[model samples]
Target: MTNNMKNVFDSSNTYGMAKTFVLISLYALLIAIGMHKGVKIFLYIAGISGALLLTYEWFKMDRPSIPTFFIAPLLFLIYVLISPGTFLIDARLAGRFACALFAGVALQFFFSNATYKVLLSQCAALLTTLFLGVTYACIWAPEMFDDRLILSYRNPHQLAVAGAFSIFTLFTYLSIFSKKKQLLVYCLFVIIGTAIFMTVSRSTSLGLLCAFAAYILFYRSKHLIKIVVAAGLLGLIAFSILPATQQQRLIDPFTAPLNDRTIKQRVGIWYTALQGFDEAPILGHGLRAYSDYDSDYKEAHRAEMVDKNILIIDSRWAHPHSLYLGSLFGWGIVGTLLLIGAFIPAFRHSSGRIKTFLFLMTFFSLGYGLTELRIKSDDGAFILFFPLGLAYGSILFEHLSQKNKTTSEYPIQTKPCITKILTLLN
Candidate 1:
């Protein structure tokens, strides 16, 4: 994993820098593995590494940006702290969120200055790695693509979301920032795009579409027709390649009985979660409280509904499948608003390729969250925070770059408050 990140980051000690880069890269790659259990190990590694780095930096001369974006995580913590019962009550859920949050915040400082390019480059490489894994899985065990390219994910939705995000990253950078490698980037885009379509995750697929459409509208609406036509053709070709039975499975989600497949089952799940929201409309019961609520109360209700044949007996998975609804249950209206704090300002003062990438992620998350509890789960949380940190880091680094440019143009007026403070201390 670290070798994949070689030459992307550097430091005074070339050997140590390479080692650190490898460690960080490998940790990120581990999280990107798409499996539920495997992602956790890297979570601790990243969170702990960030913690130690920040602790040491607290006393060192070299300092990182203030991370104004970190207020989002801070607010989340505060909201969790004042929730109904004791902190220990929601320790399991709360602890996971805390570690993920720390890992994200720490990342904002990890690749400092203009090293964000390295991070984005690393993302493209990681995506390539993931796609290669899927390719191998498909050829070695074709069954992996039976329902959807399950890849290493517990389900297709996870793979779908990750691949979609990777597409957004690759496209944003290659198109807007580094247009030098057009053909190669387009090929990579097609490969990952194929993987996303194969996932058969309708919500994630639509989320990617909506995000891409939005990107066009915001920037290149004039060529919308061409883009749409090309995309439609591509989709048709991808679908045509699917086996007849697999195509039926893809269509069943839309036409099948509500309980038997996915869509209707989702409707039932959403209805149950909304019921819980009604019970506590202000501050939610607590983090991960939905599981117990569903088991004790909603489950019995669903079972009764199932017996009456009014609804299907689709009570397999857990969580309310919607980030908006998840927030409504876990944090309530006010807490949900606070949670948004963690995301909204990430694009503050950003523009061009960076802005597009962040916007893609932001809109994608909202769309994906509609039918998936992306914010609560480990894979979802890790994937989201890592990119978010990149977005925020880009913003901070850009700000610094512009400031330096401005300062260089006018070097006499003021050195910088830092220089003034240092002079005083000296």
Candidate 2:
């Protein structure tokens, strides 16, 4: 065996199984404890543990795939110097993001290893099936549910994100490698789409709509104008049949200012974030500095509004409602630029399907970020990084050719090459 191949299949490594089990275990634990308000301590512990394990594995590498993984902790290190005496925020909250980067980078290392890759594919499949089941229950038994069918999520928004992400991954899989199963994939789209509707998450709903439109426009454009006309007619017909309240829910965001308190507050929050960004233009006021300063911002807004005879009631909200602005506030201009720098090289090197997956992930996250702060939130960090890691891992596998070899422990000859089942994920 060549030295590189030997490095790829090292005795120190457990052929990706051990890494897969550890990453997935942490992911599951995050999902379970993430929604609890005061369980951040657990997340911090998980982050530190995961980081230490990955760091150890990293040291065993002879050749590490694209060093893009260094950006998160690099930014974290900068935050350490510029922190606003808020190590708790740095260690516990923003640390999830660092952990996520570690996971993604760690995942990249296992791309040539079949066992880890299968873990990711199996995970996507499991989530899709669960979403289908939840969708079925919501569609057939409306009376048994409340306004939204959240399944086990703390809120409908979480359910929506999971459904939308699963549906996107399923389609990506079909387009890239599962062409023989196109019909089955379409069926899944229908099932998952119903639950997305049930969630009533405006961000995910709108994002899904745009993604579907883009897919049809780009891929199935044989009769582009005709398809557009048919879609328009169908949309109008559907709109006419909906009840007045449902119609308003869909239409008010575009037409009525009074109906979009969410949007208005988002605008206000974005403005304040910009103001904060100006103060800490280099390194930021530190992690969650916005949270600490938000009350003062609201007071300033109320004071200004008093002169205009405007009463501000219940004006509290979370981080700036944007990926760009949230990064701007937490990491500042330099830090934000470093974060972007990390993604660019990996993106340029990625193959087609990998790029497609990453693009959709970015699109959905950015779309939602316009109205809510994700990517740093509990559920957001987990959902975002796992697939991101998979994407980076795909690039790594592409760089190194796959080969099957039997392990001494198993004695059974299973395919060592990941491509036998799923080529893209591993």
Candidate 3:
């Protein structure tokens, strides 16, 4: 047997079981993204099963190297339990967070394995194709809300976020394919990009643009300048080709009275969130505490709008629209710092495609968080955390590879099984 093939299949039977469950969790995650129904059931299957199996595997290790970031979730959970605003705690919300965290950690283990990393890349490509096909079907017969595209997902923003995530995944996996397959992936990008544009989500568009720019900057490809110029030209072409209404919306959404009012209301909520933050700067309000003040913020914002001669249409505030603001308000400064700090090690250690992928995810998430909350939502957690776990997994795997002096890098044609899968995909 070839050395690489042995490396791929030499893992203990228990670790193999862990890998199998992790793959199932990821597949379940993709299904959850498209259907959105039975999300909790799927999440539990993914999180609990993978977490338990991975923990077993960890215990079996002679000297397991636990990544520092894993501690962040446990610490955050403790803070949630002990911090002020216990009354505001939502058990379901906490449970969802736990599920996502465990699933993410399981993914970290999956990526750390050389064989599973390649398998994941292949699985992602195949599942993404199926996902985009479904999205295209939905787009073809879209349920439009005020000329906005809502496909499968109840909210247009949800569809947009899904598209953005698919695009990111496709881009990250693009390198594994031959040039012909790469062209096909680019076509998929066009379809996803068109769907995103149809959503008319200003924040998502901006976030995607920022993500692309970050990718180009950090990727440092030989054709960097050419890629930038091409992107600019493509942007202009896309804008010109968009429907007049969408163009107007993209250029200046405030030109429409409804859009103007919506923006104003969002601003008011953000201001109110800041006020909440100021009230409890240290510990902050508990998780979902923003909901407690939702009615008050809406009434106060309604009065402010009335004073400005603006119409009050929808005055309901569920949660702060911004992730950063929500984090601050929910956990206060200490928790927020811990949350951000957790990513520092992963960012520092990750390299190559993993680093690029991490940067794109971080940039897009931060940019999108400016106008919307994602981490708090189930779909958002899957989108944000799973890939994050994969990136960290790569980092940890690299460390192990170096320590053990095994071939950790993804081997293209070393394993016949993987090669056959790639061939089918190509």
Candidate 4:
């Protein structure tokens, strides 16, 4: 085990410098994502810079290759470019998605050889800091949107999604850390969980529930029962502590079925999105198609509600509420399949721990997507793709390590340009 750990870090100085830059950029990206405002520009700059650097380093290496995980985003970008009804904005959105995937791939590729203990420790620390910042904001500079927690720039649902993702990550990676680190994660988990509840986002709550279920089913751990019980008690305590209105909001869907305006509105938006899908079943109506059919949506929404004797309401939603439905409406069945195909390679090649992590991420994303469009934009796209990229990179690294062993060949070394510069500085 010691030898294997040594082998994992045995890279040339040039590769080490590149890895340093990539890791810094990744940390920057995470900070940007967790910020409320004025940091997204940093995310864009860091993401693009990291992607470009990784691409250059990748091509400079011998036998440079693109991972199968990256192919789907590339293809999706192409489809968005040439497909009918796509505008410049649509193409731009597609470009962002592609960039995000590549960014994730780069992050993981560079960190591929690092032990989970090292990788997850950095992640846990950064995430805990972010949650602490959010917690402070919630207390000292609270921003409320419709009685739900919102940061300066993000909406309630977005905050909820971020909190949910952070919690899911900490939970999945819990077992990899030491006892002290585990305790910190538990505290961070409570902080993030309370924040999520304050967001009053039922969809995100549901997603968290689904992620927990997936973790229990697939994540092999000796302390699973203890972890589950602790989480349950924490969750119950958090819920109990929320303001009455927030608690009521969380349970509103279950307690007051007909009084849920959001549900009714979503049903209407979904109907309209599906109607658009029927028109272009193969390729859908292109990006942002849901908004284009506003008149149709309003009509369908009113008619649908009339049948149930529900009060008719006006809606001007920019995108379909559901990610799956949005994809079906905008990209159609073929494009959606392409999107799904991107993950197959990662799942095929990754280890059991990675597979479990990916499964939990996917399950949570899908569950959250049932009522929100997450991956279509920059913030949410990064949240979904970055970890996935890490998994893919690890898989590729493992494969290469094994192949080198079988052939009795030394691992390929990178050029020393960055190494030379660092040496000059030192």
Candidate 5:
């Protein structure tokens, strides 16, 4: 390829950087617009447009090594086709998932040794920390200042998913940009960590704690203890400052009964899920189909009638609480396996530290999925895959670059276990 044509997809050129900027902008816009139907429609359009442009740029240069990259979407597609009469078959929902999968596939094609090297280096960490600090303020300050735009922490699932994304973004920054100034970024991370706590998402809280431990153990920050302390103090202050209703939700016991209901009433959803699993133990009812049955369970158990309009809310929010349950309920064993398979690549090229981080995320995802359907959330989608992709790209690029080096002056040792494992996975 001529230098001019090559520059369009050049690893060192501005094209990738510009695309990243556009992608980030679009993400911020989508989040800012929130979850209204109109906003979701616009988001699907924007997501597809970006994916198309990135795809064009990618195939014009490199091709993906594996076609099994289609596994995730294929599972989702099967669920949609087979789901029962009342399934919430929203085209926008399918579009969002498809768009996310495309983005990841396109990323692999575009990710190069040079890009991976830059992402893994210390400078990347500084940039990430800076971005987190700014976004943290952007999300928090609006809530702090304006009464009309009162931060809706009503949706714990969304809060947890958003918090997970923020935590991943912050860690990615720290991992890539480890410098003296980057230490200051950890302080900012503590602040972002505090905001996560304020969201009061039990799953998110757990995920944030897991991420914190990973950062401390792997990144080895000397000031980790102080950072932890600051996080606790901030959590206390945030709780102390919120309105009484919000505070109750924040401090309520996990087992507390909702709406002053009976134990059966409170646990009705779980019981129904268990029963449903028995009916179709292997394949289950398909994604989002659980709530079609949930409506009947609620009507039977509910003393007072729930709004008919709100009945479909759970359908929009379907996915059994446990990731294991969700897997079984949504796609049966086959679907669950495909979902798990999506993450196996994270284990192939990464080091012990990165693997631990990825596994912790998977663990948290399993825990979070047990009670919430996070896969539908935009924030959750981004959180689940981006770090894995970045780390994988970083390690793979590093390995490829070292192989290309022709000098005896410097040689890098490849981990034997990693080498053998990646060979098999590939």
Candidate 6:
């Protein structure tokens, strides 16, 4: 076997798997702990480690695929560093985000092929575990049954986690069913869905429904009508059979009104952000600096408002909740454009079906961000970008010749002529 070929098949040196495991484990732990910097630190170490390995591999003459589109964001990140204030409020946050991005890029370079699949598998497994475990506890924990077993009873974080697990389970099913990994996938999905049903995040329920419709309409369009009927039937069965908390969660989106505290707060936040944007239309106040200035905004608004409690209540929540608005508010037109630039390649290369899914995620996030920042924080950032990155990276990798076709299957046997010649010459 050629030296390069030998390197590719080396079981102990699979860069891809390493990257995947690190990313998945870190993300899972972050979600569980709510420590954003911890995740970044982990990635930073992984990136450095991967870069070192990549350097060694490069010496062996293996060609790595360069992620051409990432340049736009990288350049913009640099611009943030050099550009004076009014553009960036907290340079540290911008720098940190850039560091995180570089770490991810380093991972891509170090294990371009293996990371995507491994990350997917990890996401499927980790989310499945969390969902199933939580759901099981809620359903069977005799001691806590009254307080914690029900869906709405769970805290917001749990609800979000459960909702995420639901999506993960669905994706896992698609991955398995598409790839013919049937029995395991089926069992996993059931566990995941049940867990999600327990969280009772109404928005999650809505997102899942929308995702299902999109999945059927585009990817499985031929069986669309039947699938919808089956889904409707399944929904009916689930609501009828499941706990009241679960049922209530499933119908939450339609139930949450504009006057609801959460919704009302989001409106207030939107107005606050709009005012911030107005102060600087071209560039944002600065990345990750929203909360730093929210006090002043709230105080000013309070002076003109009815109640101090209403003006400042729940203002502890940072971020405007909408990513697009947040980006504009923080990074301005430059940052927003850079992000759009980064996403463009993925969009261009993706099929209509894949693109539709991306759009759903992006769209939902936009509205959802108005209430919660799901893309800026570390855990949220990983959750937001990793899967989408994987999906997009998968599309990008598919077009490349180097990506492995079957990770599970043994590689074909072949002689390493280059290695033989190199040894002889040495």
Query: Which 10-residue window of candidate 5 scores lowest in summed lDDT?
Result: 405-414
- Report model 1's TM-score to 2 decimal places: 0.76
Clashes of 5: 13
Instruction: Tell me which of candidates 1 and 3 scores higher on lDDT.
Output: 3
TM-score list, all predictions = 0.76, 0.72, 0.78, 0.78, 0.60, 0.68
TM-score of 4: 0.78
Give candidate 6 misplaced runs (Cα > 4 Å). Answer: 1-41, 51-68, 79-117, 120-181, 240-256, 307-314, 350-370, 388-426
Score candidate 1 by lDDT: 0.62
Q: Give the residue spans of candidate 4 off by over 4 A.
A: 1-21, 64-70, 84-89, 113-146, 151-153, 220-233, 296-315, 399-426
Residue ranges of candidate 3 with Cα displaced over 4 Å:
1-19, 34-37, 62-70, 81-83, 87-91, 111-146, 221-225, 253-259, 297-314, 398-426
lDDT of 6 by residue, 1-426 (tens): 377665665644454344344445434433342222245565445434534543444443345465676465556656556433354455545454554444444334333443434344444444544656457765776444333233332354444543453354345336435555666666666655655554545555555665566656756899988887987786676567656654554454367654355566666777777778888767677755677667687776776544533434544657777766777787677767876776677667655434554655654454445445655555455544443444443454354425434222334332455334222322
lDDT (tens digit, per residue) of candidate 5 on 334-355: 6557666656655665655445
- The alpha-carbon RMSD values of the candidates against the true structure, listed in the order shown, are 8.6, 6.2, 6.3, 6.6, 10.1, 7.6
- The segments of candidate 2 whose C-alpha lies over 4 angstroms from its true place after superposition are 1-17, 23-58, 61-73, 76-88, 111-146, 176-180, 209-244, 307-311, 397-426
lDDT of each: 0.62, 0.58, 0.66, 0.65, 0.49, 0.52
Q: What is candidate 6's CA lDDT for residue 13?
A: 41
Model 3, span 212-317: residue lDDT tens: 8776775667778898798778778777766777788776665564566557667666777887899888888875778767566557676775775544445566
**Candidate 1: residue 414 lDDT (0-100):** 30
Task: Give the CA lDDT, 0 to 100, for residue 181 in model 2.
Answer: 71
Give the number of the best model, judged by lDDT.
3
At residue 132, give the lDDT of candidate 6: 62
